[model samples]
Target: MSTNYPKPAVRRLKVYAFDPQASVTLATAMANDYVIELPWEQRWEAPLEKGPVNDYVEVIDIDPAAGLFYAPVDLDDAWLRDGGLEPSEGRPQFHQQMVFAVVMRTIRAFERALGRVVLWARDERLSSAELPPGAIERNFTRRLRIYPHALREANAYYSPDKRALLFGYFKPPESAADVQASWVFTCLSQDVIAHETTHAILHGMRQRSIDPSHVDARAFHEGFADIVALLQHFSMAPVVRQLLAASHGSLREPGLLTGLGEQFGRAIGRSKSLRYALEALGDRARTHQGSAESIAAAIAKLRETTEPHARGGFLVAAVFDAFVTIYERRSEDLLRLARPGLVPGNGLSPDLVERLTQEAAKAADQVLRMCVRALDYLPPIGMTFGEYLRAIITADTDLVRDDPLHYRVAFVEAFKRWGITVPGCISMAPDSLLWDSPRPEEYPALIARANGTPEGETPPQARMDPDDALAWWFADMLKRLQFDVAFDQADDGLGERSAESEEQASSCKVTYTRRDYRSGPAGGRNLRDLAMRVVTHNQRAIHQWLEQCTTDRHDWERLLGVKLTPACARVADVNAPAALRSISGGTDPDAVPNVEVHSARISRRTGPDGSEMHMLIAQIVQRRRAYFDPEEQKAADSGDKGAIGALRWKSPDFWFRGGATLHIDLRDGRLLRVLRKRIDDDARLARERAFRSGDMIAATAAVTGNPREPFAFIHRGS
Candidate 1:
């Protein structure tokens, strides 16, 4: 149990310069010390059930061969005492450290892109965006568990059920032709670890994406994981420079950045990597941006492939292609900057190489954020490649209105090359696919209510200062909500003090402080926090009202299993305004215009194939659970007296039991349709009956010692 104690903070760690593949061909192969601010430790044998002992990561080398948590590199004299010259030279301790470092690095990247904390699905309390009682929240699965040697095969996976990353080590190919070595450890490979961690992080954000109901669902998982790993390669300045120096600015040429999991591929006796860069499509295969017909042809060819990897690879290729295009364009300017006037045709200067590398790195960083942030704009379920393209466009459009460099245009061109077209677009123009903001006239009540005036009274002059303006606006909104609240600036009587006097004083005097109190459930919370709560409450109320109207109009009957209730029937708020704010460049929440929650109440709808149905279409349909399963009570009642660390079987963690699609008319505030998730009773009964009959036959055969087929007696009579 002492081993479960928190590990000391890691100031710096020397890890592999890159993956083993990059080390083989790049000059930047020297192990570099990476700074990790959080604490981490290795728990060789013990496993943690929930809370992490450390802040960073908890490495659980589940393999029996993984002896005591001995990480020599953690000590100051590791390089002098132990022969720790090269961390990448296949040491068990180094492998454990590398896996932990890479996983944390990947987590940080996602956090940076979202501009907020990255919450894992296992963090039950902060499951949704709702803030908890403590103004500040810590990670539930604080230190992500890593199984460095979980299996003996060339496979690695992120287990959502366990909330741990399982990495495998495989024996090299037996054939003499395969010269890589005896063992291929996936944890050692940066790409492999990064890829697996990305899967975990993405699932944390969107759990529904794991359901492979649609083709894009699984492919998105694989492709997005690869993209994160691929972008990480560009993140390291040294790695980019080495690759640029080797290829002489021709990124299309075979290099470390062009291929993924090189060491693993070679060990398996493969000529190429698991995946190659899209630039390898060849100069002849490249589709010009202007050639729409040609791009369409390429897309048609890609669509012919149904396999997840193949389709996913195509998407990776498409995005990578855009990165390459941007890199090339940005590098041209750098090339000229390296050598003023006409650039030399001969070898380039060292300064130019560094400049060019920086440009490429910058461009990749932007593209990476664009890809990750786009996830917020995507649908909850049933996404297509084209829909992803639309998400990218809309997400970028919301953040940056003026794209003078036409970075978005370049992405549109790249997507077009692969024949990835936006669904329901009026034209091929990039703006056509971008998500539209609500018209100003849509939500008049929000402004009317927050106007800081009674029904028959005239409003006072607005505050000119931005902070004062927001404070005033927030107060007004609270008043409109019928909440009894008061706000006043508590100006400290103390005025200007000499610099020496201020320094002599223990603490500085408070110049300004706003005191606010509300007579409601949100009383003790911060005033701004309460304002947000009010806004959120109002938004959900509107949605629930619309839903109630629709259900009343339809006169819906009760289902077989569900117990209806006022709270259970209430529709969930999809947090459209927050999502919009993510892309919206507005600094002041008060200054931002009221969000228009648009919806359509259609009597009938028809598909392009000519099929028609009477229904309503919502602006945005969110996936919600029909009910919660009482798993904790079931476990307690089962008389399982095991502690948190006990290895007991747990029932499935289905966050949502049953699913339903609520169609709302956002414009008119109406819930038009309810498409509930259906279960086939006939299929369920047949399968259960077959299982029971087989069990009975198996029991009889076991007792009689007769190796007979299940239900053979019944067949004999026939």
Candidate 2:
């Protein structure tokens, strides 16, 4: 291979600004086309294959319902590479291009926020017993498969079981307006593509969150995806500017930016978009411009909504309300400067519109970043809207010590108005909701164990505090990761290029690159791939370390909320794997509860004031089998260990999980915080049981057994 081989840093593709319907309207037609510049990396020496397949995602344009295989568009083609195929509903290739572009764009947003490459959820079929001895390598997914036309219905979803995104198409109803096309393709909608992609990204971060543990569990997933898709609209400056001009700088007005799935929503017999953020306020307040009374009314309704999408709408509205608040604050000066006494319905000057657009984009970007960063701070499983509020507050406060613009305050107030409140918080203050930091005195047993001594025995490392010991362990594990994979500097494939680069190769633009790879290895590899390889290779060692330090320690159990020792026997008829099941019919002397180290990654975030905070984030989860019957669960929750142990003889109804997310600062090797959900908490267990046996379950009883693919049914006709 030639050392000087050149590849463009980005491939710009034209996609619909919103959906196909936006292109037909005179108001939005001029701005309906958008050019998405995808970060390009040349993995192979030759040009990309027809599928436009890359490391992150693969676009397989097969219309199985139509019984036809559409050839994938070659994005590497000279003409298409220059400006991409024009946006067209009739063209299958364009559908492929649009989905790829929007999906990649969404992926890039998450990567930027996370400060690390995004990995998809692992393959669900892999079992521990099937693996050979000492082989910790489970099948981690490489590419998220995309089928542009997988079904002949009005739906699209990210399937965790299959590790693929299936988009559908359907004919519009006769009552549907603006019916120029014969069929509506979900793949052609930017909102749908981004929303589904967000689901995949979120699933990668929190695997067990897909379990409907509470009303907010699945609802959080839906609302969060919509939030990402809606906020992404502001990133398109031209679209925002055009909409702002039309609405006279009032984002409160109904428009394409706030409504999702414009074409599909109308086709499904809706008057406007499929679902608008403003509608969360109820019919009377959709046009109320987010008044205090209107938002409170919306909050009251949130308690009554149980459907995933409908309940998720409240979360979306809360986040959108925060964005709008931030935007208004950010653009207040611009509006004042444009005109001292600007009227509500008056048109703004073009320059003022441009300035307002920048402000809106900036606000949206900041809010989106806050939402994404909060994912790291969240508990590994059983997420709630109230918990998400705390995550957003804590995550942002950690990065930006002084919130001069009051970004954290905006989020708190918005969530508070929507009736979202942390369960134990005394007040809605930001500091009151932050996750408690770890204390040295609280982990005496863990510290003693870490020093290689028994509970009271003083060892050589007795001077080391709990924080220092934890930091040391985390640092040691990260050292084993060997993040510095070697790469040839001359090879553009291995170098880090900015996502904003859009110039063609002929322009001879000197693409600025960062040296993320070091000089010690022979092969070029992706950072995420290298990290996963190292972690998986040493999975057993890591698991053993965590289990040994935490097992039988009351302090550790309190801190992490997982039961590690005194493993109860496997329940009868439980569908768990052998490795996950306890060995005996009662308390097992030889068995330790299964401990899974899901992911450990480095987070390097920079504050606005040029301060850098680098830390390691890792999650640990453990599962326990339990019955769904309230009486059985109550007996198990009793203080008697005998009763808890005896329940193992009966058939288990479900697997209950407890987990913790660890945030450790690298500067001084100090433990920052541990966010957890307790495994043995009777209240939580009761809530989960109720949710499982509640109206939500009865509504979806037809799809009860197929929990692995929750998105498949939830996204139908959505």
Candidate 3:
């Protein structure tokens, strides 16, 4: 404890100093951001080495990046002696750990969202290939390089090209002397670090999503990042409890939870925060109006602004409102648990206070889970706030069918207040807006057939399990599409299938392929020839299957309602135009080109109940691939390419990028869900327009414009 260097261990760090915008801060003129010690129960500790190294990330200085920051000089000692880390002795390492801690925390958040480990694109080629499965990390990440002080400026960005987070620092304005002197580091702010980490994680899951295609595309990135960072502040249980107690149990009372980035805001001469959720505009008329009315008016005002951050504000506000509602509803139970005659307005006993804080923490945790899980239900392209609401409802309904607490209702109400609605929903009801389940009868039939249960015998118990339904349904559907349905004999839960039993199961398989196409003229293929190949083969089979699924003329027809279909496909036609636009701005009906079946494997996973949930994970991709040699790309970047080749290079990747991952529940043989990554033509066009207009909002090299030209003043010195 008395050595020249302080040892590293679990220690508390300031979660956030006084939120500058908090009413208390304004009244008290608090000097530093509040710090909280570590060892948080909810915090995830990644596999780390001395530079506080983790498998997925490497913390390094901005220079050559050869060295790493081992640990801060006893953050505990610094905090105990001073209010926070001293700017001169501890600020550098302080900023390093802050970035590392928040980045790890954000990774954990995304893993929760994806329901699996985040596999970065680099992981596929570099580290994973050599490591054993689940061995701490098999190809965790070569190094999602983090530069705590990459530039001398106000902005920080995640560069997909470099696969690194570059935090910039700059001299604080003269007015921000309260926080620091000489410089303000973006890396030092928890919000900025969390926000940038989200971008990296999102890119790993859905890389194409980084494209500035639609208004919501880039805005979704920014807003979703803010949501993660903001919600994470709640996980600092001590801070949240303190603020809640201070605000008299009212989260809406303009406290620490309502604002983000006080230090950054003050450094930039802003009075409150860099951005705020609970703050209302002048037109909001906060004191007199009801909660919903005020939220609605604020949303209306927000809509008048077209900037990505402003639009993202609408999403943040709605979600924040939902959180508040849930917290209030949950507090009701806590109040009931309080001593007799004790109410919220009156000070409660310590026991009751502890109970209230615990309940509030639980509410925040559940809300964060809901937000992350909803991502799996969202479409791969052209997202809108309305679609997000629907995704939330559908995702929640699938997981928790009965919502006694009306959490979904709270979300719907919040969105409705903002006048956001799913385009095709019949009403505002959560039930109506939710993604409809497959017809109940289809599962039984599919499961019965897959299990090869004799006619009238009660389908196997495993088949009766609703969660496993999609697996069998997918098997049956594939058979109908003329696929070879091979029951996984290895899966004992599906029953042993020997060579003899395999032949018997084959009887259930239907092999159908329509092949009627004329030869190409002079060895050249046009759109017409491509259409012939598609309509005559896979498209015809798909069309016939859709017809059967839609109608009830046959015994199966009445039972199966196909809820999924191919979103896009590719055709190879040298004589055809560069690209053929679909009539409805999607995929052409008769053309199923460049379709490749990647893999289809049946596996069993144990459910929370310990029941085996058979799952068929099938992946198929439409390759609208782009092939440009590295040297050619460099030449293009150098502006040395010919007009024709350059024009060709300018075209977008024609083939649909990431394909769909079908999650088929084999328990009851139903299509549990489909996770797809396909292009939306409208969104693609919008992206092109944005590129032309140079209005890209995301922090990525893909934007291809001057980082300063749009607003040079911010980056003037750097």
Candidate 4:
């Protein structure tokens, strides 16, 4: 492609607002069709061969049960590119288009929130010593594969092992006589597509979160995905306006906007959608308008629910409740302006409806951003709903110093109503819930070094603190990462460009003329391109730096909450060729533990007052072999070479991971806070053992030996 050729900023595609079934209704027949706009790919070559592939996802329409390979939708085709293949139940290409568009939209939302390009989970096998150098980076998955028609059953899920999404289609049950469509495709549903995509994205961010470690572990995955999917419906203003018109500008009412998987739910013989966030309000509450008693009963029911979807529903409800509160607060003035004495039965004027729709959409967008931003602040493993609330508070507080809109307050009150409470917090106040800041006095070494005299000559009050040095060293490493440059360029290109403006730019018919889209200072370099370049080119350097930080640093074991010395006895000599010899049992007692530098990226967020806060978010992970047997676990914990060597050479029952997520302020070289899970915490270890031995194991047990495909089982019946 020539540089002079004009490339469109966005590609508009028509899709169903809710699902194909919504179009069948006489009132929603025309309103159900929605046109979504995606970023245009100027580099895509050969429209027919490319299919609906993009930088983040690839749509592969393969149906094994039907023994059919549906031709991939050529999104680059001129006619299709202009307006997209019309929403149709009969066409398989339309299904491909729908999945691709929704997946990209979800991905873009995440990238915008996180301020970086999304990277899929790396292949675990490539980390072995047997693999050649640079194999991990060379084999990094850049695009998530999307199979619109893979299974014959009703379930659809994201497979971490295959790095693909498998969407299924099924015939409407005989009991579902009201369903108009004979076959229900999960790919056609925007909620289903977005939900599965979130799983993939979340797994990439925290690969170990899929483990069924506790009640909240797996449930968090299901609930968070549901929340994302449900909130996404409000992003489309036109759709929200139409939905508001039906419900009289009330989100409390039962409607397509609040329901998920409507067509599939109906096809599966359900009177309603698969799930509703408003259900947390209780039937009586929704029917009889709102009441404290009905809300209290609903919250109690949420506490009793244990199944993943049901439990996760409470999380969705809590978040949706916050959104509702925020929306109501924002639109209260508008409601009053419409009618001073606005009664329950009074009709909303067109102007009031438009204003309320905008308020609802804005509130939803803010809530969604807060939720997504909280992901970076969460501990890399073992996430709970209570901790998630803290993450949300801390993340939002960091970006927006002042909460004039009371968004954080709304989140806190809602989570509390749903029985979610953070441990160790003095109160439900937002300030109390914020992650504790690192005190310099507690870290004597860093303070001494900062105030030390010379390298050789120490001051009277000088004292060496290895842990503080490590923190500073990590900060220096972040400085070397050069995230600021990449993010600065990304801001110039992507941050300022709004979806509305992009759609308008590409709306009019135009010819491919001499024009340059790369006229900006970024020069066509995006955040992904720049960030990936830094990571891929410096993979070995990063590994070496991490190894150096962990080597012989006993203080790091306490500072990072991970074991650094006394490498696992089960690790083969080939894997640790440079292992330090131990006096007892000839084991490698001094060998350095494997430290995984999971991710280091920049977060550039603009506050409500036009203030910018740039941060370097990094995660460091270390895993230790854990045993189910109490005696064997004691032996492993003893740290005695002879005792550790006496244990069986067989693989342990599971790996216990400990790591910290570091939030470094770019304005100042300060380690703001560290969110960590301790690997050697006896209490946590006991909890893990009990969880594995108890019925919780059944919650996420895989049909096959492969545990990586948990979503297959999680979404089995959904």
Candidate that scores best on TM-score: 2
User: Which residue pairs come into collision in candidate 2?
Assistant: none
Deviation from native of the Cα of residue 575 in model 1, angstroms: 22
lDDT of 1 by residue, 1-718 (tens): 4658544454354455445654544353442333333223232112212212134456765575544444433433435222223465467666766776678778878776665445454432232245432122222444457878776776777776666787777776675243345677778878778888887788766645665345566677778888888888887777677668767776666556766777776766675566665644456345334375777677787767655556777778788878887888888767656556435566666777788789888989889988987776554544678878877886676566667677788888777777676756898677987754332223233233334443224344541332232233234222222121222233223355456544533232111122123233433222323323333333333344333322211112121111122223433334332221111111122211121222221223222245443322222222211112334324322433252113322332222222223333323333333333222122322333343344433345457633222112211111
Local accuracy of candidate 3 as per-residue lDDT tens digits, 1-718: 6668643454444433332223224533342344544342211222234444554677766543324434433333444333334323235766665676678777866665445455443232222123221122222334588888777677777776667788877777777766644566677777878878887877665534555545666667777777877887777655666666656666775545677777677778776577887675212335544476765665576556556676777788778778878888988877665647676467666666666677777777777778876665555544668878888887666666678899999998877765565767788899888765455454455545445564347645545554344354445355543223223233223455478655654553321111111133332112222222221233223333333322222333223211223442233231211111111112333322233332333443332344454454444334332223435433433344363274554563332333454555555555765544453233544344444354434343235554322222222221
Task: Judging by lDDT, tell me the better candidate of 1 and 2.
Answer: 2
Write out the backbone clash pairs for model 1: 398-583, 598-666, 599-666, 599-667
Weakest lDDT window of 10 consecutive positions for candidate 3: 576-585
Q: 717 in model 2: Cα distance from truth in Å?
A: 2.1
- Show where candidate 3 strays beyond 4 Å: 1-47, 63-91, 112-114, 123-140, 175-180, 281-304, 333-349, 438-473, 476-646, 649-661, 666-669, 675-718
Please write out the lDDT profile of model 4 over residues 343-411, one tens digit for every residue: 677677777789988999889988999999999988877878989999999999988888888999999
Per-residue lDDT for 429 in model 1? 77
Cα-based TM-score, every candidate:
0.60, 0.85, 0.64, 0.84
Measured on C-alpha atoms, candidate 3 has an lDDT of: 0.54
lDDT of 2: 0.75
- C-alpha lDDT (0 to 100) for residue 46 of candidate 3: 29
| Candidate 1 lDDT | 0.52
Please list the C-alpha lDDT of all candidates, in the order they appear: 0.52, 0.75, 0.54, 0.72
Candidate 4: regions farther than 4 A off: 1-9, 42-49, 128-136, 282-303, 340-346, 450-475, 479-530, 536-543, 549-555, 566-592, 639-648, 696-700, 703-705
